[model samples]
Target: MSEIISDLNTIDKESIRIAKKYKQKNKNAAGSKEGTFTKIAFISISLIFVVLMLVVPLISVVINSLKLGLAFYIESITTEYVISAIRITLLATVIAVIVNTFFGIVASWAITRFNFKGKQILTTLIDIPFSVSPVIAGLSYIMTFGRMGWATPILDTINEALGTDIQIAFAVPGVVLATIFVTFPFVSRELIPVLNAVGTDEEQAAALMGAGGLTIFRRITFPHIKWALLYGIILCTARALGEFGAVNALSKTRGGTFTLPLEIDALYLSGSADSITASFAVSSILVIISVIVLILRNIVEYKVKK
Candidate 1:
């Protein structure tokens, strides 16, 4: 009992000494009053610059959208083609987010929880989408799936065998594929650091108790990264919603493959004042969706901090 008491006293003394040293270090590192003023001024200028460039444009879009009145905005979005495009965009976003979320979990888990050959290469491959151009991604799909594409023979054989004619390029499926490629990295990248920080201590202990892989993941891992997962999902959804270059490269531009962004571009290019108004209305919708995503992101961040 005395030894335990003595040990506790020693620990308390060591903690106090470390705390004092930390305080002294910070005190020495703190800048002078003029330097503090300069820092504050720099931060304020940056904030103002961001607000002017980014916030003002969004506000302008909203204002112009409302200028035509709520009725025009309503009629614009309610048009058949516009509605179809919105539906297509939503579908692509949903599918991409779901597919990427699953991939993110599996890929991040493999990268973080295991040591393997080519681990660095695997991580680099996962990040390729981030640096690759979306246009290139779209063209790659076209080259692989188009009528004269490399896989054309395989696709033709399958169709012939099944007596079914399947179209991929210039189709909804192609748009989804492009979206998936562009958004491949968001969720997994977001979760990697989180999983690394969390480490495998609890999972190892759970395994020692004979827990299965899925059981450990569900009850142990998922809860730790749920917020990060949600954050990544929101970011992926935003990117998918805004994806234009890749989808445009593969889309037929009319019939059924047009997404909301494509429709907006078409409307703007039509050169009619009403079409321009409609474009603004659609832009406003996208802006609103983006704002909602930002809000959800903040909520997730707050929860994660807690």
Candidate 2:
């Protein structure tokens, strides 16, 4: 028992000695790292700028939204025009998100899984909306579907033959189409890296194990990319809800087409503080929805990481 006690004492002393040596070494290394200090300083300053850019405007929006009285805010929300604007924007945002989610998933699959002629060109083409001006994007639709458009005659013939009218660049279809165009790349862009990380080997292995394509997708591919896919869709939906230029131009804004942005613009034109406050009331609703969606996104990511 005495010998065992002596052995433990020796081991404890040796461990303490090693720990002291390691601490000295780490302290010396940290003291020598001027470059590391500079890097941390730079990163801190850059982060300050980033926070200022992102958070300041959001704070301003919230403050402005609260400038009105409670009754005024309630009345603004209850107005029929404001209610319609909210509904239309919500409807367009939801439909656009649904459509874009499918496009992104399928396009990502096609782009990564297949090789075809003009594949590179087609990939570049997907980014056309990002490069082109939003106003021009809207104009292109107008020029294709308006009375003076080339397709107008084709549409006229179809209308004559079928006795049914189809409006492509107006109303709900126009809003949804414009949104889909703007948001098409998000899901594809997100899923590409995830799919690439997963590699093709898993899918191939699953296939060899007698798993069908859909089964492989469900059991293997979906789990891998689901988080990124959802993140991209949330971002796309947010952008779609706030879209102004493309929607307004394509919609013509003549026959009962008033999205939230358009409605806000109309309020500004009226030159009344109350109208602008009404607009802010509507904007506040969007801000709330965006905040909730972003929160949900973070929660999803946390669950995924865990």
Candidate 3:
């Protein structure tokens, strides 16, 4: 009887142990499944947001542009005003890139390679355009160069002295200057951190070896920041192409002075279906240009990493 009782107790204890172990395993499996589901749900939400915001708008634009067929697009793009707009945009982009690139390099070098008073102030001023409204920028330019501007008389006197009808307001030079003001920070902003990260070690060593200023820059610094500089130029080009506010304020909106953005607006406001289609066509061109810039930027970044 005693042996049987002991055997029964042992069986009961073993069964309890097995049951507890099974419960623990089931709980762990349930927890793991819940975590996996949560992860999937988060990813799904993110993908949906991207599709709605970015992909949908882009697809809509492309489809609208193509609704009238390829020939129509070509026709609209080649219109006289459209051609002039493209020319103006391209010219401004080129000038902005050149001016900003030169100054960006010099300013970035000065900030990174040397220490001086008012350095912080200089940096703050350089970044002002990013914070300031483009409309305000346009107004400031107008206030300086417009008919009632303080400098208008001075400019007029100079023009008379030079025997030229040089006009800054409502002209190509004004457009170029506005573009430059907005894009002033691109290259310098891109290069500053790179210059800081690269530090002055290699530069100092080269200097110790009696490398001249230009030589050191040519061989050492330029190679380090060339890709970043290119990236900045690409950004500046994109911004210049799409700049509307400042250009609108200063431009006369004539065939000779209008930019692509202004031309698009004019087409849209004509209240004719055909003109609207033409506007879409022109807008499609800008979109294509933006895509091209993005591709080039990626290529440059890849090269930089290599």
Candidate 4:
């Protein structure tokens, strides 16, 4: 009897343990199902949002651009004013990219490799373009370089000395200046984090081995930041290409200083159906360029990751 009782007790304990384990497994399965449902719901919402906001608008632009015909689209984009705007846009973008790239590299090097007074101030100054409005920037430039402005005397003296018709406000130079101001911080901002993450160990080692500054940078620093620099250049190019507000404030002459964005605005504001259609056609060009830039950016990002 005692042996039987002991065996019965052992069987009951085993049954209870298995029941608890089975119940716990069922609870886990239910939790997992709920979690999966939540994930799928979030992903679905994101896809819907992207399709509505981005894909639809892009598709609309393409369709409207071709709504008339390919010849109309071609004619619109090839007109003298449109061609001039394209040229100016490309010129501004090229200059901005070059200037910002050089400045970004130097700024990143100085900020990362050394310690000095006003370091924080310099960093903040670089970011001013981001915090301030582009319209405000353009107005400020006008006030500084306009005829009645304080810098007027200096500009007049320089033009007299150079014996050339050089102008800043309400000219091509002013447009380029505005583009540069807006896009200047992009490259530097992209580089700062990369340089910080890379640290200064290898640069210091190269210097200790008797490498001069340029040699150290070329051999040691350049390799680490090349991808980052390329990424920054692409970003700066894209931003400069589409800059409108600042350029608009400074550009007074259509077909002379107008960029692509400004040209599009001019077409739209003409208050004619044909002009509106032409505006969309020109906008498609920008859309295509932007898509190309987006693709390039993704490629650079992939390269950096690899």
Candidate 5:
């Protein structure tokens, strides 16, 4: 009789354990359903936001651009003024990208590789363009290089010596300068964190191995940062292309110094239906360029991750 009682007790404990496990699993299943619902809700909200803000505006621009028919749209973007604007915009973007890339590389290298006085100050100064408004930057350049400004005499002396009537304020050079000032920090900012993450140990080791500075950089540093640098260049190019306030402040000559953004503004401000349509047409060009740059940026980002 005692053996039968022991067997009964064992069977009862096993049944109780199985019941507890089933209860715990049901609780977890309930929690999992709630979690899945929350995730889906967040994703839906994000998709709605992107569709409303970005997709809608882009589609609207495209529709308006072709509203006047494809021939009219082509004519609007092919005008002499439009062509000049395109040329100037491309020129400024190219110059800004080249100059900033060089400066960014040098600045990033100095900041990452060395301990020096005013290093923090130098880093802060590099970021000035990001904090400062483009309009303010344009005005500052005007004040510095305008006829009555302090630097005017020096500029005049150089112009006289060079036998060239080169103009900065209210000219092509000024537009380029403004573009450079606004897009200055993109490359450096992109590179700094990357260099920091890479650390200096490898570079120091290569130096100890009697590798020349260039060799060390080319073999070790450049490989790591090339994608970052390309990413920065793409960003710089995009910013340069869209820059308006600074370029507008420096350049008032419509056909000579206007970029695509300025041309679009001029067309819109004319207050005619045709001009308004033309403005949208010009805007479509920028939209296309921006899409291309964005695609390139994503590709570079993917490469960086890989």
Candidate 6:
């Protein structure tokens, strides 16, 4: 009993010491006020220009989007082509997000939860899309899939073998493929750091608790990184919605290539002033979508952290 009391005293004394030390560190030391002011001044100055440049352009986009009137905005937002493009873009983005979510979980699990050959190389390969130009990204697909390209004969043969005509170029499927390729890395990269932080111990512990793979993943893994997953999904959706270079690169730029972006270009090139305004109107719609996604992501991430 005496030893127990002594131990309690020692712990209390140690805690008190720590609290005092922390207080001192946070106290107004001799030069801390000046140093603090200097740091604040430097950051304020540096961020001033960044805020001006970034915020002004963003505000302009929003202001322009709203300038055309609520009825006009509603009509613009609900127009047949705009609606169809939104549907197409959302469908492609959702499919890509789903595919990449699985890949993110699998790849991060494989990278961190196991060891294998050429792991570093695999990691580097995952980052290739980030460095590659969207234009070149589209070209690589074209080189493999276009009419005169290497795999065209194979595609043709397969279509004949199946007793059906199949054309991939300048179509919805091509746009989807481009979206998937470009947005592949977002979720995986987002999850890597989160997975690294969570580590394998909880996973192992779940196994010891008689949890199966699905149970282990659901109960132990998913919650830890759900925010990151959502962040990646929102970002990927935004990128896919705004994707222009790759879609333009692979598409025929005619009938089958009538995406909202392409339509905007065509309208601006040959149509009247109203069509040009409609182009900006479409752009303004996309910009609004991107902004909403970003705001949702911010809220979700902040809540998760809290």
C-alpha RMSD values across all candidates? 8.7, 6.6, 4.8, 2.1, 2.2, 8.4
TM-score (C-alpha, index-matched) for candidate 1:
0.86
**Candidate 2 to truth, TM:** 0.81
* Candidate 4 C-alpha lDDT tens digits along 1-306: 999999999999999999999999999999999999999999999999999999999989899888889999999999999999999999999999999999999999999889999999999999999999999989989999977679988988998999978889899989989999999899888888888999999889989889999999898889988999999999999999999999999997889999999999999999898888899999999999999999999999999777
Q: Write the per-residue lDDT of candidate 2 for residues 39-143, one digit (tens) a residue.
A: 999999999998899877777766776678778878876777777777777888888888878888888888877678897887888878888777887788778
Order by lDDT, highest first: 5, 4, 1, 3, 2, 6
Give the distance in Å from residue 290's predicted Cα in candidate 1 to where it truly belongs.
0.2
Top of the candidates by TM-score: 4
How many clashes show up per model?
0, 0, 0, 0, 0, 0
Q: Which ranges of candidate 1 are over 4 A from the true structure?
A: 1-40
Better of 1 and 2 by TM-score: 1
Tens digits of lDDT, candidate 1, 183-252: 9999999899999999999999999999999999999999999999989999999999999999999998
TM-score ranking from best candidate downward = 4, 5, 3, 1, 2, 6
Estimate TM-scores for all models.
Answer: 0.86, 0.81, 0.88, 0.94, 0.93, 0.79
In TM-score terms, candidate 3 sits at 0.88
lDDT of each: 0.92, 0.80, 0.90, 0.93, 0.95, 0.78
| Inter-residue clash pairs, candidate 4 | none
Question: How do the residues 1-306 of candidate 6 rate in per-residue lDDT, one tens digit apiece?
Answer: 999999999999999999998888877574699898999999998799878988777777556655666676566656676666666667767787788878888898788778899989999999898999999878888888886679889989999999987676666777778888888888889888888887899899889989998898898898888888888778887787777778788765444445566656665676676555566677777666877987898897886676
Greater TM-score among 5 and 6 belongs to 5
Give the higher-lDDT candidate: 2 or 3. Answer: 3
Residue runs of model 4 more than 4 Å from their true location after superposition: 1-17
For model 2, how big is the CA root-mean-square deviation? 6.6
Q: In model 5, which range of ten residues has the least summed lDDT?
A: 144-153
- TM match of model 4 to true structure: 0.94
